[model samples]
Target: MFYKYKCGNEIIRVFVWNDDFHNEVSVEDTKTQKSYDRTIREDENGKFFTWNRNTIYLNDWIKISMKELKEKIENGERITSDDLCQAIMTDGVENVRFIAPLNIRCGFGFFLNGNEFKDTLCKVEERWNREIKQNYKIVLIPVESDDSVANSADYYTEDFVSLIKCGNIKIAETQKLIHQEQSNEDYFEGVNDYFDGTMGV
Candidate 1:
């Protein structure tokens, strides 16, 4: 089995089942089905995706990890994300502690830290379901990286507990997409709709 990550213009499909140690990474382009002989270290250096110590590489935006942000303050550098660039320095922080990430999927790879952050809750009302059946996607605030590393970081994993909100999977939205062959006509038909056809979904 493998997982797909939208990095830059490539839909990196990392095949995790390969036991061949000769090549640490067995990756391929999802569209062309072409494979590459590479190592995780190479990918970490932009052969694919960089394995960063503190920044997160998202498809739309880049985010800085909390530890990296704190170091920026100590070194005195401009921040990347605009969320709390000035707020943290002006308002100041106290009693900072890292919490295991609340979100499992696209939430965050870095551990969540709270200095003055507070949690807010909203009741699951019947009104939402009346209009749309899907659950709402919650927005989160991640620390910004300093200007120095902002250019480098473009933007991963796991477990523990939950004391905040609860959710159940919507089986309807969990459908798997099966690949279908498309002819030259069907492929070029939507050229006008997409410029380079490299845009990530």
Candidate 2:
């Protein structure tokens, strides 16, 4: 399922509000459709004619479960950008998190040290709450590298968790590796850091 999120360069997902209405009732009571005669009326001035005169507002995020969202994507009925904006405004989140997977081939990726990135991210988080809605800019913090390694290694997950706890990052959703038809590119313009001074693998 495809969930609509506020995305940026390093920011994976954030919240956005949506203002839409849901049609839950039908007018003209018939055997085919259920009747809403017993439903409580808020604005009593209006009465049902063809459909239930009651207007239902959907202000919060339209969270279709993973199963549901995927079905809609398959069916080509998924939500749009407008829908996502409405959802965030309606949900009203004080703070949000963004996370990404990391693997090191040469130099560290996204943040060289914990403190530098942490401090930058803290500024971003604050600015997000004060200024931007869906246009926040994410700085790509370079990761620190260890020269002792010879081959590439998966990034440490503990550091990721620590960043989250310290409010420098957030975990959104786990990514699934899906193979699809696509062109392949093998562009190696630079040397891998892992092979800098180490012997043959």
Candidate 3:
């Protein structure tokens, strides 16, 4: 069976399959392409057993119902990214897994915009830094495809040492640093080359 639920501007698809021995479920966000899959097995006594269940994390909170979120949207309420973050924090949820954006490929782990909510941006930076400190080789990439977004590249720096010690630098600052040192016509290409050179790639 398959079901579709709308949450604000996003669509979530839920798929389920069952047999005499086991049941499988998959939930996917059409907007972000983030997904979770789970399976449950039936025992001899006809009781179901599962070691783990899939969950949807809105920020750090585990949101149990897409139906409720859809209802709120249908009722003409506006749900912003900040609202999602607030819900997660207030719900006292923990151990949430981070889902990378669909546009971001492997080797890069985070994408931040200059227009993001300040608190949400700070929280994400903190989480990424913590992962870095734990020896995760996560790279922060700042994207600027146009003049408006490119203007924000003024926030990131190329000082990797400072970035390691302080995780607050923006991707724009790094771009600015690269522009100053290199004469590449493509800003992103310059940034990519910088990292590649640093990594000896």
Pick by TM-score: which candidate is best?
2
Predicted candidate 1 versus true structure: per-residue lDDT over 1-201, tens digit per residue? 234455655556544432335435455755667875444443343423342122222222233334455555446664322322222212222212222122222224344333322222111112322211111121222233222111110010001001211111110100011112244455676674477665453
Query: For all the candidates, what are their Cα RMSDs to the real structure?
Result: 22.1, 18.7, 18.9
Candidate 3 regions exceeding 4 Å error are 1-70, 93-100, 104-201
Return the TM-score for each candidate structure. 0.20, 0.22, 0.18
For residues 140-167, write the lDDT of model 2, one tens digit per residue: 2223333322212222233433444444
lDDT of each: 0.30, 0.29, 0.35
Residue 190 Cα positional deviation in candidate 3, in Å, after optimal superposition: 62
> Can you list the residue pairs that collide in candidate 1?
56-155, 57-155
Scored by Cα lDDT, where does model 2 land?
0.29
Alpha-carbon runs more than 4 Å astray in model 2? 1-63, 82-105, 108-201
Clashes of each: 2, 19, 8
Model 1, runs deviating above 4 Å = 18-23, 42-201
Least well predicted 10-residue stretch by lDDT in candidate 3: 148-157
